[model samples]
Target: MSAVLISVAELQELLDTAGSRVRLLDVRWLLGDPDGPQHYLDGHIPGAVFVDLETELADPPSAAKGRHPLPDLAHLQKCARSWGVSDGDTVVAYDANGGMAAARAWWLLRWGGVADVRILDGGLPAWEKAGGKIVSGEEPDPEPGTVVLTPGHMPTVDADGAGGWQGLLLDARAGERYRGEVEPIDPRAGHIPGAVSAPTAENLTDTGHFKPIEELRARFAGLGSGPVAVYCGSGVTAAHQIAALATVGIDATLYPGSWSQWSNDPKRPAATGTEPA
Candidate 1:
C-alpha cells in the first residue's frame, strides 16, 4: 500500500512530471471560519481545486449525528468527481494547518476506496518552504472524473461499539477536553468511559509535521497493544490520529459519532478526570 503521507518535494516532482495525473485538493477550513473560500482565494497551490469541508465532506449536522456527520457515499462520489478525480489517479489533499483538515479528505478517500490518497505533510507551509509556488484565485473547472466511491475500505465504530470495544479505544481530544474541565463546543464535557486520553496534537511536532515513524511507534507503544479505535470531539481529528497510527503500521478504527454524539445522550455514561476509567 502507498504511504498515507507525502512530502512537499515529492509532491512537487509528481506535479512537475508529465502524465502524473495527481489531483490536488486545497481544503482550507477553520473550525469557526466562514471564510474558507476567501482563504483559498488569498493563495493556494497552483492547479489546486478548493473543497468546502462543511458542504462537501460532511452532511448537515444534528445533535444526534454529531457535528460532522460523514457524507453520503453517493454525494461524496459526486463531489469527488466534481474535483476531477478519476480511476487510477492519485489524489493529494492539503490544508493551511498541518494536515488536520486535509486528513479528512485523505481518510474519506481511502475509506471510499481510492487506492492512492495522501496528505501533503506539513501542508501549505511545507510547500512554501520547499520552494513550491502559490497561485491566487481558482483554476478553471477540471474535466469531470469517473472515480467510483466504495465505503468499508476503512474500519469504523458506532457508539455501542466504542463503549464495548475490547481493544484500545483512544480519545483524540485535548487533556482538558477529555477531563471535562472545558466543554467549548459539545453539549457535555467528559469523554466516553474506557477510552484512553491520546490527544491528536501530540501526533505532530512543533514544526507541524508528523513525528518520525520510530517516535510515533514508541509513543503508541506505551498506550498498550490491541486493536485500536480513535475518537475526538467530533470525527474530524480522529482521522488525523488514524493517519498517524497508519504510519506506524497500526490499523485503527474511527468513531464517526465521537463525543459529539456520545455526549448528547443522557443515557450513555461519561467519565471525567485524568484516568482513562
Candidate 2:
C-alpha cells in the first residue's frame, strides 16, 4: 500500500477496528462550490469533520500570490489542531471529486510534516459503495491537539524558477487548457513555457481511484532525468499530481502559485499550442 493513499476497503477497516485512533476529514469541495459546508452537512462519513478548501486549506487569493497561496504555518497548525489532528495520528482526507480536492489536505498536511497523512482513494462515493454508513450535521468540536508543524517537507517552484526550471516542468491541467483551446478561469489562457502536458486526470481510472502503481509509474516514466515539478489552474489539482507521483516513488515539487499566479504577471511568458515550448 502506498503511503500517500488508502482504498475504501482499507479506510472502512480502519474505522471498524475498535480503539483505533484514526482522524477522518471530509474535504468535499469543488472549484466553484462555495457551499461545501451545505453538502457536508447533508451527509458525510461518520465522525468525519469538514474542512473548507477556500479558507482553511489556503490563504486568501491575491493578484501577486495566486488564488490559493499556502496558508501561514501557525494558522495551518491551528486549523489542524481544530480538526483534532495530533502528532503520530493517521489522518485520512476525502472528497466527492475523486481525490482531487482531498489531495490538497493530504499535501498540506505532509508539507506541514505530518508523517501519516493519506487520501481516501475514490473518496466519499467509494465509502458509500463499500456500505460505510454516513452521518449528517456538524460533528462535535474535538479536544485541541498539541501537534506542532514545520514546512518544506515537500519541494516547490516559483514563477521564476518554473520559467527556468532545470528539471521537467509539468502542466497538470487538461490537454485543451494546455493547448490554450479554452480557459474557464484565471487572468489568461495557456501554460508556462517548456512545460510538458501531463494532465492530472489521467492519473485516475474510470472508477475514480488512482491507476495501479505500475500503470502510474509507466505513465510518468522517462519524463524527467532530474527533479520534476507540477502546476495547474490554481495549484489544487497539482497536488493530486504530486500524490500520484508519490505512489510511484518519484518525488516532485509543486508550483503552488501555478498558472493563476504566472499568468497575472505581464512579463512572465505564456505559451500556447503545447509541444513543450
On TM-score, the candidate that comes out on top is 1
Residue 267 local lDDT, model 2: 94
Top lDDT hit: 1
Q: Where does candidate 1 stray beyond 4 Å?
A: 18-20
List, residue by residue over 1-277, the lDDT tens digit for candidate 1. Answer: 2299999878887888933489999998878888989988999998889999899999999889899999999999999999999999989999988799999999999999999999999999899888889889879999999999899999998999999999999999999999999999998889899899999999999878999999899999999878999999889999999999999899999999899999999999999998888
Report residue 76 deviation for candidate 2 (angstroms): 0.5
Report lDDT per candidate: 0.91, 0.90
